[model samples]
Target: MDPSMEHLLARKKSSRSSSRTRSSSASSQTPSDQKPREEKSAPYRDPRYETLLNTKGVFLDTCDLDIAVESKNIPETLLQGNQTVPESTIFGEHQFEYACRNLQGRNEARIIQDISRLLVPSAETFAMLGSKHLEKVIESVNEGWNNCIPLTGTRPQPDYSVGFRREAFSNEQLDKLSPFIGNWLSGDLSFFMATYYMYFPFLSCEVKCGAAALDVADRQNAHSMAVAVRAIVELFRLVKREGELQRQILSFSVSHDHRMVRIYGYYPVIDGKDTKYYRHPIYTFDFTTLNGKEKWTAYHFTKNVYDNWMPSHFKKICSAVDQLPSHLDFGVDPLAETGLSQELESLSTAASSDIPLNPAEQQVATPDSSLCGVGAAKRPKKDVCGIASDCSRSVTVNHCASCLNQINAHPASFNIFASRPLR
Candidate 1:
């Protein structure tokens, strides 16, 4: 089955998780009463991979997978290692907790202010709508940001011509976009932050505000990940347009729920099946920290990354277009195709702070408040096939040996978090 179909077949945990499921091809064809309730719309970090492009090995066959748990004693050589904590600016578990404290609670105005501050100072070639236009944003969402806008920052703001909003594509627009989007047609789902030119958005984001300001169900739904993947497809289309003005590289789908934000950059990567390049997830950032306001540091880190890498992507694309007899003529190393990513950065990476502290452990700073402590938690599923989740179980990959082995393993320990048997 398609990975997307697998998600539809799987039982939903809540309402927020089901936001897109309603428009799922299978959902509309089936009675709503027969389908699982969509996950509640809560302010939480969701990490479930919904599409084939995103997920690897999901036990989809509905076959029972019962593995006898085996424990392996750590090797003495492996046990000796440096216990140094990661010191990357993008490390953010504590950062999320601190940022939340700084906001106090569901303070959307503050959130905008923080985002604006991050964007305005840089000399980057990007323009955004000013505070006045941003104010309209809170009003547009049905659940408006229930806070007054504050006069912020002394620096000169740009005469911004573009702004983004949370909008769902109308039927007409969807039909127009059908050719570009391929099999990923999600219906009427709202975009969180989208920049528009002449009412058309080339890039999009699905934002999730992590706060206790909502119900438990709301705090647990990270459904935006699925939405972001779909949006990336649209962003990819924007860059591939026929006009010279359209062939740009910043085209990407952004999913930054403040805490666990993944920016899936579309790049022409070599999928093993063919030597042809395919656009896939390239840039990712996960700052799972609790050191107050540090989580927002990712914005700064992103700006730095953009300053460092955006041009490289463009240059590489241009080099191909130039079509020199060979890269040797240009005096640029063949390996310079993806400069920054190849040298200083990773094309696909996930970063979590070494600090063992989790915000879920300390629900809220204020004792008298009602906050759903749903920190960005990663609940990896166990496979009945006993293959590593990353292993696709395709003809190309081999069966898992760990699943077949049993040394000093404790079966009960493996079952602690294990749920459904693979069918």
Candidate 2:
């Protein structure tokens, strides 16, 4: 070969060899050796994750409760029943004797009598006893309610919850109304109240082993009752029954320890632009220390709540459902009236306290600009990426491009409560 041509050919061969070496090195790289593509996280924080990671549980004090007051007056609904306690009824002669005997024998050691023992019953023995005794009373008065269902997997899973079945309102007219009624509530009529099967829970009970757990039980009861009252009020709000604002004690909660039982009556009232839940002390008594006369009063009160109060409350709920207008006069956003966006808050974020304990009411941004405008393509479900509205002080982000669209959109239904869930 000519000297210049040979030199050019040698340079070309060196270039090809370098290129192949670089290609081989790149092809042999492992995933660990390669740079990772950055993964963008959801914009809004998950309330449950925040709760599990950041929020600390603390027992709430009486003063820490929203609109809580100390009172001695028994609510009228609780005293409405005129039934006399018969010997066969719970806490009466026969039943009381049976309870006392059941405490004897080897189980006598488990019986909590001393105030010291009342401070800490073994495991949940005191709570179990309280539940058993209350069930007896419920059986005596449970005409067909068939409630007293225990709830689980929630922040305020009370020892007992009393609610009606979905079929209670499953009439032809209601079925027709469900579409309209369901819009005001969660998308589904079945899970509108709380869960898929339980509808319109009127009362809840949280039992504790001793006085030590009494405050915790009270907090749990307060949270549960607040949820129940809010659900009812929101239902009525949908039908625009402003007059039927929950002034009367609509929801009740029973909290008891080994020694004493406390009943609280809850109602909601409009304070300025915010809905406020009020907890009133209905009656507190020590069943163990009380005589026959006093003990029967507790039984009478329970019967009145189950038989008299609850039936009336359930009727009111049914009436509201029936009054759901067949046609829409104007487009009413169900969440608009309550200062919530059905699309902003999700079910998982509803773990916060529904009671607004602070001066600043929780607010969700319902911007004028909606992705689901006329003739616009529907937006797919997006993972919620915003602050949990529990005591949300202010909202600057009016429009979330990553969030759900308005108009028939399935937003995560968050609790409208103003504070984090009280431990």
Candidate 3:
């Protein structure tokens, strides 16, 4: 070979060697030295109690209730007549003893079932009783209140929830009221129509056991009770009674961890244009602390809520409904007369079939949902009517200023309900 050709070949070989050395050095570099791979951002986590309060621009403060101080402070009327078990006997004492004796399993469902079977009154048993007032209210297990805070896209399903039975109100009355107050104003008649028609829900209970933290229970109760109180406030607002609370305690929520139970009263403070929800301590009972003597304390409280609080709540709702103008000032809904029945049927059919009108906006709890986990996935942007169309806010051309304001505030509800057709 020529000497010049041999020199070129050696130089080419040297260049290839340098390239291999550089590649090897890059491969062996520390993570810090290497350009990092782009990470897909984590999904937005679900809002807990405090986070929910901040996000919705609501304030949370605590208050002490007069009746919560002592068992004697409970109204005799509340403690007496309408109880599932006799007022004199200790409620759930035997079951409490049994639970204490057995090595209680950590299964959340079993814990809740045991608690419900022993402590909480079943809707069937309570309703079957001959009592005048008790028969009107019922309890639901693991059913989410459909008419939750419009701002929160997902509904917080409590372990146990209570509301008035639909039979308590006449269909004709609901029919007349559904036109003006239905749709987005879930705080009104639509709440009952939206979910299982468990009208005017006033109480909820959250149960936690085993590895499940009571803190998570509190957060769940907070979101649920807030929604309950807000619905009450919305009803009052319609009747021009929004700011007229004789007592701020509008609703109640109970948190249970085996033998430990805590009760909270939820209320709203209207600060100018915005409404703020506050949680007040009602009572806390630990059956283990007093050698099971205080086992009946929670029973008495629940009885009072069922007997006294429920009647008063129902009365207020009736008064508000009576005050609604027979003819709505917001012109006329084409579906007013037959709307309630048609909508109720449609909702029931949809619920039974388990088919959502729009799957994108459905509130589904992911399996991985934990103490700090994300809830229902983020939904695609919806139009003013909540449909996947290009409907604009200006489409509220027919809606009154007051109606428009409510629509703007609770876009989620309007999106869900506005598209609902009446027969």
Candidate 4:
């Protein structure tokens, strides 16, 4: 028998025996007791109540990047073809090659393995229910308020506000520290759009608030406020534990200014140390206007909440920014650019397919033959768009044969494909 096969069989036997023991124990419980037992084992148990357990260092500091790239050999398959480059190779000008070389090395590969081992478990826990507790609490509070208010007349509104803050990581630092994170930002578009929509509203809301303050009369409101505050704190703690909180975040505050309510805050870098206070950029949000008067409002909730309240706001922000139009155009598209016509050609071809496409079409239209098969396709010929051939006859054009074949295979479909208007 093969030694590896024997080991696997032995492990399977042990797992089966252990599972049987657990099953038997569970079966022995009384019907009444089963609920409690299940609750204890339930995945939804509050992660806040659990201790801050460091799984793996998904939140890589500069030092970790150095170690991952320098001391631990890791492969940068995407950046470079080499598999034996140091993780620190990103610090070098020839980062892609360094990453590729390191990727070939066994020692460097361990760094990603270690990161995966740590990140996967923690992510699972966070996904299960660890992250939602705060949202649930907030929802409950909102529901409670709704129940207490009278529908017929103008009821007294509660004086409350919420603010958020996040720390920043430099582009250089992100490049060196975790290129995977950078890659994720580059690859995901919807993630960035959602973030933009989310924060825009909140910032707009805070702008509307514009230095207003609120007052609470009874102890009950104060207690409810305290509960909300505690829930926020717990949310932060959970984010920290899950390795989601970034060093920078957006912070928000809600207050009253006598007659009108207000919300205010800023996105700022959270000082790594305890001694330094929250330092915000000069541009803070104060959304006090609604038709030029103060009224109840909600801004981009997700972006503000994630930026301010979640510890992993930095990561989220980075991920979100990666999805932004600016980042995609500058960062990923250049490296991933095959050529103009090819990209348009791909889009033209994709549009012909029966498969439903994203409503927000990100793919650009290009000539089928011009794609380099990397990123965006090159723009079509000026002449094709009605420009005279004499305008730029000297300009060289390249097209991809494979993309042309695709277009040729479906000429009827291609002819019908209309060019989308540029934004």
Best candidate, TM-score-wise?
Answer: 3
RMSD of every candidate to native, in Å, equals 24.4, 22.5, 20.0, 27.3
Please provide, for model 3 over 1-423, each residue's C-alpha lDDT reduced to its tens digit, 9 standing for 90 to 100.
Answer: 112111111001122322343365544532211111111000112335467555864334553333233323333444343444554332455654666655265556666655554455554565576557877776766654443333354455667778776678766556545542333221221323223456667778777663245556666677667767766776666666876652367777777766677777777767444677767666666766666876656666677777667887788788877775565432223334524444435443533442223212233222122111111212332223322224433322122322333433334444424543422
TM-score, every prediction: 0.27, 0.48, 0.62, 0.20
Please, what are the lDDT tens digits per residue for candidate 2 over residues 1-423? 112111111001122322343355435532211111111011112224323211222112222333423222346545545545444433555566455444433221244232222221121232244533222122111111111111212223445566655556657546644433332221112213433335666676655555645655566666556666666765666566744663556677776654467877776665433565667777777665544345544445665665556565677787887776554322223444534455345432441343222212211111111222122212342322333444432211222311222212333433223322112
For candidate 4, give the lDDT. Answer: 0.24
Name the lDDT value of residue 16 in candidate 2: 31
lDDT of 1 by residue, 363-415 (tens): 10111111111122233322322212343231100111112111002222222
After best superposition, candidate 2 residue 51: deviation in angstroms?
14
Q: In model 2, what lDDT does residue 313 have?
A: 69
Task: Kindly report which residue stretches of model 4 are placed more than 4 angstroms away from their true locations once superposed.
Answer: 1-44, 48-249, 252-423
Candidate scoring better on lDDT of 3 and 4: 3
Prediction 1 global C-alpha lDDT: 0.26
Q: Is candidate 2 or candidate 3 better by lDDT?
A: 3
lDDT of 3: 0.51
Over 4 Å off, model 3? 1-49, 57-60, 63-98, 103-105, 147-151, 180-194, 210-212, 332-423
